[model samples]
Target: MKLHNISFNNLRRRKTKMAFLTIGLVVGIATIVTLVTLTNSMSSDIGRKMDEFGANILITPQQNGLSMNYGGISLGGVNFDQKEIRESDLALISTIRNSRNISAVAPKVVGAVEVDRHQVLLVGVQFDKELKLKQWWNVFGKAPERGDELLLGSEAARVLNVMSGDTIDIKGEKFKVSGILDQTGSQDDSLIFSQLPVAQRLLHKEGRLSFVEVAALCSGCPIGDMVLQIAEKLPAAKVSAIQQVVEGRLKTLDQFRRFSYAMAGVVVFIGSLIVFVTMMGSVNERTTEIGVFRAIGFRKSHIMRIILLEAAVVGVLAGVLGYAAGMGGAKLALPMMAEGKQVQLVWDGVVAAGSLGLSVVLALLGSLYPALHASKLDPTEALRAL
Candidate 1:
């Protein structure tokens, strides 16, 4: 019979032993696949949440300033020739090469207004954009949707002694308190928010913007390139990335990826060890069989081929089964791992191909020594055990 025929017959006769070897390989491959798939899903989910966290880019009017401090003494400098960033100029941001990375753009106009003889920072914002940009805001009431409505911060509401549905006067304009934000421990807690057009008119700075907040942190997004592009597009505006925020989000996602790879590496090593030990034991048990083949005019190469062919078949079988099992495990584990976050399972052809190839390579490498030992066995010596 041919070498492959002999290999197939041996596998059929030793079904239990082969089954154990296959199981070992399958477990290892499955563990690796599950980790990789789960990591990718979790990373995607976290990326979406990070995008909702807040803006990582800030754009403001450009101004020239001079430092007057000397000998570390307290001194104030003058800012001159300040340039305003037109509300219309914000459209140039959408023309950037990486503009698709931009998530939300919130432009604001700011000015101080008096309420009950107390000066309060009043901010004009596009509520639709602001609500989308600040997803974490838990307003006690509702967002302001009308120019005659206002959203007050927790501290601002407390100072003004107002709640939802209360009316307050600003610059001779009466606005109803639409909502009071929950305490966020930020500067926002002391500010009053109103519709963009209303605030612009109230501040008498129509068609002008104080600053813009851009949510542009996405997977593999080039924050630096975007900043430069925005600066180029709006020459009178200062565009900058919030480095700490960008680095923190990137580092978090990277940590998850690195951790999955590290775990996969450990499982691979154990898998290799399992294959080596099992194949070596099988070779020892088949010494007499190998001797018979040698005595029957079968060459050393033929004996080696029979042993390796068996491993190759097992590898192929294990690869298919392992990939299926791994994907299932990832699906089941996602909910618990993601803590209720919705994650879509990915069926990657590349990952499937990779797993198959890895299994085959590991099997061949692990069985190499045993195949060599079997081929080198002295026919007479091996036959004596029979």
Candidate 2:
């Protein structure tokens, strides 16, 4: 009979012990897989949601003003001509080194316009990018479609005494109110929104933007690096990143990842220890059998192979069961853990294969010392136990 067959028959005779060893390793592998899968899914979900909370980087016109005391009276020094960014030049942002980290770039043309002869801030925006950037804005009605259509901020609508579906005049041209925004308690609350091209034409500042808002945060890229890169690309525009939201999310994720690593480490250690103890016991029980094989001319390497082969078989079984259990655990645990947010699990085939391989390797390492001790047994002493 082949050595492998002998190993297989030995395992068949020791079902109870094999089952215990497989169970211990499976539990460990399952916990590890669950933690890793959950961490990966959480990172993606958090990153996407954080990206939606609006632009962390503000690109606005660089102000050039001087303040000084003149003739015993404090008077501000004359300011240079107002600088505006050209809409055409916005594409240069995509050439930055960390440009891929930028999620959205929403340009705006800020100008003062009259609504029923009362002056208010007029903000022109590309609805596609603006809508994505300001996802927190809850509009009661639809976003503007036509050039003549516009959305009113909550405070603006209140001040103008108008609601959605009302008509108002901007820059001597009639505009239909398509939507009214919910109260946001920000400067946006007092601003009126219109399509970029239409507002530019109305304000007579075609292709000139007051500022741009950029959303830039991803898995592990530094926001500061992105800001520097944007500044390099657009030297004339002031680029600054707002860190409140991004920093908070990053801090939370970091803590979560650390906890996962700690727990996984503890579980893996316990699993390896269990495998070692079980293999050691198996070696002791088979002492007389080993002695008989040695007397019958079995080589030390052959004895070692039989012990390792048994461990490898158990490892294979544990790995398969562990993966299945981990996936199931993640699916069940995520809802409770994440507070009802839907988390789509991203399958990592590499991790799955690695877990399988790791299980086999762990089994081999755990059984090695026991197998070696069995190989060095004195036949005369071992046969006495028989």
Instruction: Give the top-scoring candidate (lDDT).
Output: 1
lDDT of 1 by residue, 123-157 (tens): 99999999889998999889998889999999999
Which lDDT values do the candidates have, in the order given?
A: 0.91, 0.87
Clashing pairs in 1: none
Model 1 residue 186 lDDT score: 94
TM-score of each predicted structure versus truth: 0.82, 0.87
The runs of at least 3 residues in candidate 1 whose Cα sits more than 4 Å from the true structure, single-residue gaps closed, are 1-27, 34-38, 70-72, 252-270, 293-306, 312-353, 372-384
For all candidates, the clash counts are: 0, 0
lDDT of 2 by residue, 1-386 (tens): 79999999999999999999999999988898888888877788877777766788899887788778978898868778656688987999999888878888999998898778789999899998898888888999999989899999898999999999999987678999999999998998898999999888888889899889998766676888888988888878899988887688678878888998999889878888999999999999999999999999999998999999999999998998998888888878777666346667757897688678878888998999999999999988999986
Lowest summed lDDT window (length 10), candidate 2: 337-346
Q: What TM-score does structure 2 among the candidates reach?
A: 0.87
